[model samples]
Target: MAKAMTIPDYHPYQQAHLNKPQLQFSDIAPLIEHYQVQPWLTVTELGRSVKQQPIYQLQLGQGDKRILAWSQMHGDESTATAALFDLLNYLQAPEQAAWREQLFAEITLYIIPMLNPDGAAKHSRVNAQGIDINRDALALQSPEGQLLMAAAKQIKPHFAFNLHDQNRFHAAGPYPNPATISLLAPAYNAEREINASRRAAMQLIAHVQPWLEQQIPQHIGRYADDWSARSFGDTFAAMGISTVLVESGAYRGDDNRQMARWLNFQLYVAWLAAIASDSYQQADVALYNAIPFNRSGGMKDVLLQGLTVSIGDTTATVDLAINLALTGDRRARIDELGDLSLFSAFHQFSVQGLAFKAGQAYPLNTALSLDTEAHLALLQQGYTHFSGDKALLQASSRLPVLLNPLRPTQGSPQLWQGATFLLVNTQGKVVQAVLNGQLISVPSGVIHNPLGT
Candidate 1:
């Protein structure tokens, strides 16, 4: 009888060189050259993108079972590409010789690090032809799509890994935590039936779920099983190959997704080990089904609850939900107002008995500047609002004030300027306030403000 192969700890082998969240084809060119000289790896030009950028594939191991993995199908989603390179770095390290030998003896690996180099270079989601390669899998209209299909035909892999990144809004289950990582065994048919291929994929996911749960706690999300004939994952599964979809999502406090990259490397090693040792077969597919599905619209960046507002004759109490828009700039906007009881918040404030007032009017000729501290000082004084140049308002970070230059009607304050909500408690005392989706503290006591205003 043979002894069980012990899976090595992945922490020591984790590649620390690639830490950035964004990557491009040019960024990996040097690394590719470095790997070309290795004795155990075979580097080949799979094809070229619409922009004439070379798409390369790296092949390693000499095992009987074959596995195919690709990353950066969408150019903007570069985290998985970073992880694949990290994995390559680990595989070529002299210290991992024993583990590499065992893995190579049991399975052969084929990897396409950046399938859509054209889109990657421009930081776009689609190829240079403005077509999404994943959706073009069956059409084969795009060169990248055609190249991927050709590679799949030549490798005839037993298993496939489709890697990508998702938006930060997704939550793990319905919990407050963000979905740090998500996985899926794509459905093979429109009926969403589970065949041998999908079953195998599910079992592998099940085997990795426990370890991932231990690592991320309530941050693992099992992607919903949706069958799309044009998608590569479903199409490959329908072709009788076990396919797994891995989506890197946002983790708390790690905006660059560096932590997500490390987690991806860990997952790759675990999946490869399970396949090489046949340990995935022992895993229960039901466990995969049991993993929580990703949910959306659960929480916002900031929330203000219970305030009375008067615009001339009408007065009403409302709650406000504010969110930060990711436009490579510092600008927070009011996403919703009025009863937002269904939603959760990263930062919440209560002003149950406070009277709210909008910002005061500023002269049109007033000189505007990008002084954040000066703007915040104005808020600290009694003025709740100020209308000025859009550029200066958008550039200021110290100002806890909203921008609404349009100055909409009182009832419909859609784009009202300096839309700060001054919260005055009963007995005519100003207790707390909300500015530009952030809460501020008054002399009476501190309000629950996450932005530290």
Candidate 2:
């Protein structure tokens, strides 16, 4: 099946407008306007979110072999949602009509582009009620969860695709490579027995394994099949649906997740073609089983190795791992500190013969002159933190500007503390400054804050 399958190039079908991070409903609203007029497609409101946001379902094709797929269940996971719109555009392309015609004639798709619009608005994981709709599958407490259940029973799809995005700080295996895509044939029972429906789903993933490797080598992984009773994929599998869980993980430099989005589009087309053509039956389940389980906390944003940190009067050389929080409180925290030899980061620095020190605060005398002689001088003088007039601070400096007075904990870099301090060398020279998890080179004078906040 690997040799026989052909992966579609995602460039032609890539929705240019939806190529962004944390995509809200407003971003894709204009592109979906034409679906209303398209004769082949049917768009209907599934239900409304807790905040009264309308949830939409797009029905494509008129075949008995049904496939149900949805995205943005956990709102921050917008990569698959964008790719779903791309899939819609791909189905309408005149150039691919030949294979697409067969696909449409064989399999019908009920796609819910955004399930939790209220959560999507705020780039949150849960709904407006602070409830995780995915976990609420059995409870049916969230309106979003109820709508999904209704859609499943109404469509009774032969196959279901549970689309989601996993954290970037995870490894494909023990290797340093990040898991770009995690596939799963969700287990229906507590024993995790592979039934006929699960067998087909496993084969489908196996059929696409080679193609995924061609695109993202050593980056493919398998999500743990823990038989999550409350999860939609597992529940659907228990209901005799061949449920496939495609978790869009992180690509090394693709911070916006466009790479993952493109891969999702390719997999959808290829897998659908396989299912439509019945090519997945020939695929070996061992290929799917061979995929490495995703290992969490495998990576961090920055790692400062061999740094001398002072705890009271005792100084010890250890490694510090820093990660930038993505959602609610978007601050860089010292996730782990002390002999983090097993972990890796996008940016790693060896601060040998250097001691960590808390930076002093300097009052703003005038407007913040950034990257100027005055700025460099201030850094040399050990003024890493700043507190001053609000208007002057609004100009934006590389350093973290303190609105309120500094806390006692802010003085020293502690475990799970904020990453804001100075790295001083033997001569007491401040050679580096870490602000908001970003490493700054003092000598090169390249100290710009990556997080604008």
- Where does candidate 2 stray beyond 4 Å? 1-9, 311-313, 365-370, 392-411, 447-453
Worst 10 residues of 2 by lDDT: 400-409
TM-score of each: 0.85, 0.92
How good is model 1 by TM-score?
Answer: 0.85
Q: After superposition on all CA atoms, how large is the RMSD of candidate 2?
A: 2.6
Candidate 2 global lDDT? 0.81
Residue 286 C-alpha lDDT in model 2: 90
Q: Stretches of candidate 1 above 4 Å error?
A: 1-17, 307-317, 328-330, 348-351, 354-356, 360-373, 382-453
Please report, as a residue range, the 10-residue window in candidate 1 with the lowest summed lDDT: 408-417
TM-score leader: 2
Give the top-scoring candidate (lDDT).
2
lDDT of 1 by residue, 275-332 (tens): 9999899999888988899887666666677767667798878877766554344455
- State residue 229's C-alpha deviation in candidate 1, in Å: 1.0
